[model samples]
Target: MRVAVTGSTGRLGSALVAALADAPFTGPRGPVAWTRADLDLDAPAGVVQALDRDRPEVVVHAAAWTDVDGCAREPELALRRNGEATGTLAAACAERGIDLLVVSTNEVFGGDREDHTGYAPSDPTAPPNAYGRSKLAGEQAATDAFERAGAMGSASLGIARTAWLFGPPGRDFPHKILDAAARALAEGQPLRAVDDEWGTPTYAADVADAIVELLAEDALAGVHHLVNGGIATRATWAEDVLGRLSIDAPVEPVPGTTWARASVPPRWGVLAATPLPSGEPMRSWQAAMADYA
Candidate 1:
C-alpha cells in the first residue's frame, strides 16, 4: 500500500522508511516521507496539506519534539508538536480514510514503579512530565479520531509505544559507549554512567520491523509496546558495551542527580507488550546488539 511516514531523518523514522520500502505491501509510490520542512508540526493545518499531497493509504506518524528536558521547560511547544499536531494528523487521516499508525512512548506511564516488572499495555497511564503528558494526549486524540471517523472501510489505527530507542550505527548506546571506551582506553581513563535509571533498550530497526508487522495486521488496534525483550540499568548496559568491545576499563556507577535536567524521567520505565500474540516476543536486546556489532 501507499505509505507516508513523518520524521524521515529521525532515529526511528529512517529505519521505518527503509523497512517500509522493503515491506511486501509497499506500493509503487513507495514510502513517501515528510520532514519538518514539508509538514511543520508548529502549524497543525499543514498536516492536512501534507497528507493531501502524499495521498497515502497509511500514515506512520513518527515526527515529534523528542527533547524530554526541553519539553519540560516548554510544555506549550511540546504539546503543540506532540499533542495538537497529532490530533490534526489523526483528524486529517480520518477524513481521508487513511490508516494511522503512530509512535508513542513508554514515558506515558509514571515510571516510578521500580519494583514492578514493567508497565503493561492495560496499565492506566499517569504521565509525570510534559513530554509524556503530550504523548498521552496524542494517543488519546489518535484513538478518538480513528474511532470517531470510522476509518474508511478497512482503515484503522495502531499505536506502537516504544522506549529507550537505539540501534543506529553512530547513534546507538553501544556505539557511543564503544567510542568512549576506545577514546578512554587510548588515554587510560575510567568510564562512568548513571546507574539509577532503568529501562528497555529498543533497537530502532527491530521496532521498525514490529511497526511494519503491526500495520500489516488489520485487526490490530490501540497501543502495543514495541520494545526489546529486556531491561537494565544505564550503567549495566554501558558495562555490557564495554565488555563486548573488550575494553578493560571499569565503568563507575553514578546517580541521576549528577546530571541536571529540567525534566525528571521515570526511574523504572521498562515496557512490556502485554496481551501480544502468544509465541511472539521481541528479540533480546543482547541479540540485537550482537547483530548491530
Candidate 2:
C-alpha cells in the first residue's frame, strides 16, 4: 500500500511515520512525507496539488490548526486551516480514488458531562469552542466527500478522534505538568492543576498505531475514538506524572474555570471505542508517560 502522510513531523504525525515504516506500505517515490513547509494546509490548493503529485493510494490528513486559545482569537484562521484545508484534501482524495484517514478530536462533543457515560461514535456533535467547531466541520466535510465518492465508486474514509494526547517530540499536557513539577520542585512550591477538567489522556504512539490499523482495514470506516481505556482529571494526571518522576511535591487542586483564560472544556471528554478493535486496549497515559521524559 502506498500512503502519503501530512503533518509528517508533528508529534502524532512523527509517530505515524514510525509506525508505517514497519508496515507493508510505501509511497510513490518512497515514504511520502509533508511537513508544514511541504504542504501549507492554510492555503489548501497546495495540498490538493501535492497529493495529486504524490498519487498515493492512501492519505493520512493529520495537519490542522490545533491551538484552542489561538483558534478563539482567530476563528477565521482556525476555520480556514482546519475546515477548508480538510475539505480540499477530502475532495482531492475522492477524485483520485485515494483512501483518507482524518484525525479528529474529542472536543467535537459538548453534551452534558454529568451523564458520565462516555461518548459513542454515533452521538450527535456540538462543539463548545471555535477549535472544536472547526474540527467538526472538517469531519463533516470529509464524510460528505467520501460518501459522494462511494456513491460514484469505491473510496474509504476514517475519522480517528483522540484526546489529551502525550508523548515525546512535542509539547503535551503531561510535558507541561512535568515542567511545572520541575519548577515547583526547584522553588519548593506546590503544583496547581485543575481537578474539574476530566479527560482520558492518550499516548501519541498508541493512537498512531491504531490509525495505521484502521487504514489497513478498509472494512472499518467513519468516526472512531482511539484513546486510552479510561479517564482521569488533569490534577490526577499531573499528580501521576509527579509520582512517576519520584518527586514528592504537593499539588493544589482547582476547578477548570479558574484556569480557563479563554476556553473551558466540558467536565467529561472520555471517549469509548464503539466497536472493539482486534488488538488490546492502548496503554494507560501514566504507563506511557513513565517513558515520556
Tens-digit per-residue lDDT, 45-104, candidate 2: 777678767778888888888788998888888888898889878988888888888899
Best by TM-score: 2
For every model in order, what is the number of clashing pairs? 1, 0
Give candidate 1 misplaced runs (Cα > 4 Å).
147-154, 179-189, 275-278
Give candidate 2 regions above 4 Å deviation: 27-30, 149-153, 291-293
What lDDT score is found at residue 288 in candidate 1? 83
TM-score of each: 0.91, 0.93
Return the clash pairs for model 2, or none: none
Task: Report how far off residue 178 is in candidate 1 (Å).
Answer: 3.7
Q: Report lDDT (CA) for all predictions.
A: 0.82, 0.80
RMSD of each: 2.2, 2.0
